[model samples]
Target: MTTQQLHEQILLKKSFLCVGLDVDLTKIPEHLLETEDPIFEFNKVIIDATHDLAIAYKPNTAFYEAYGIKGWLSLQKTINYINEKYPDIFTIADAKRGDIGNTSSMYAKAFFEDLKFDSVTVAPYMGKDSVEPFLAFENKHTIMLALTSNEGAFDFQTLITNGTELYKQVLETSKTWKNSENLMYVVGATKAEYFTEIRKIVPDSFLLVPGVGAQGGSLSEVCKYGMNNKIGLLINSSRAIIYASKGTDFAEKAREEALKMQQEMEEIMSLKFKV
Candidate 1:
């Protein structure tokens, strides 16, 4: 999806909420395991229940990759279901993949072409050569990791080099890459204070923010600084939303959780844009 299309969806839905489909088999409803593909079944129900409440759905690749071939098949089915049923809903492959140039190109093709995800997360530690390959795809976004929500982020992302922080350097340097306009970023909600400085560097770029809800990143605090003229924030809530309940009413509970976030987003957008 193009950036304009994404912005339009936010307006139409009155939401910028991205439901993270980071499914865990053990945490899912026990009854779902009896189905042919428990993971896909679980995802289908969640998507059906909350698709309207959310503008995007992100399935972290690690969840699928853990189960090997069956898991991958389930992931493909989930994406296909979303594309076929809700084409306007932006899809993100939350695969923080980055490698050598050639390998990165293949990873891009896998998520962008074969799986048909609208965006994919990438780690910037490998630098421009590794990430630019993903950005080469037209109308697709490459969300580079910036200041993350994890405590370990302090180790490298905040380290100053030549009077500029490492994460800031990544943002600045990435702007010069080919097709840089297609680049977005991953700014963890836990580091909401950094958004002020981050926006100074890439004010217009979209940010896929994780670490809300279960991670305890304040939604209101994130919006206070992270939002832009276009409301360029996809705040994700994984465990808190998806695992709201592990019973037969899991999908309903998930919808309830997502609705709460979406409602908050609508209010925030109203105030930010004065809609």
Candidate 2:
């Protein structure tokens, strides 16, 4: 999806919520295991239940990769289901992949072509060459890591080099890459205060923010400094929503959780943009 399309969805839904489909077999309802593909079944129900409450869905690739081939198949099926059933809903392969040039290109093709995700998260440690390949795909976004919500982010992302922080350097340097307009970013909601500085560097780029509910990051704090004129923020809530209840009513509970966030987002937009 193009940036305009994403903005339109946020406006139409009155939400920029991205539901993280970080499914784990052990945490899912026990009854789902009896089905042919428990992962896909679990995902299908969650998608059906909460698709309207969310504008995007991000399936972290690690969850699928852990189960090997069957997991990968489930991932494919999940993306296919979303594309076929809700084409307007933005999909993200939260793979956090970055490698050498040729390897990165193949990863790009795998997620962008084979799986057909509208966006994929990427680590920027390897620098521009590792990221440009993913940005090459038209209308497909490369969401580069910047100021993550994790405690370990302080280890490298904040290190100053020649008077500029490492994460800021990554944000500024990435703008010089090929097809940089297609670039978005991953800014953890835990570092909500940093959004003020981050926006100064990439004022218009979209940010895929995690670390909300389960991580205790406040949505109001994030939007206070992170929101832009177009409302460029995709705040994700994974465990808190998807695992709201591991019982048979898991999907319903997930919808309830998502609805709470969506309602909050609608109110935020109504006040911020007066829409």
Q: Give the TM-scores of the predictions, in the order they appear.
A: 0.99, 0.99
Q: Give the per-residue lDDT of model 2 (tens digit) for 24-115.
A: 99999999999999999999999999999899999999999999999999999999999999999999999999999999999999999999
Residues 43-86 of candidate 1: C-alpha lDDT, one tens digit per residue: 99999999999999999999999999999999999999999999
Clashing pairs in 1: none
Per-candidate Cα lDDT values, in order, are 0.94, 0.95
Candidate 2: Cα lDDT at 19:
94
Q: How many backbone clashes does candidate 1 have?
A: 0
Ten-residue region with minimum lDDT total, candidate 2 = 141-150
Model 2, residue 176: what's the lDDT? 97
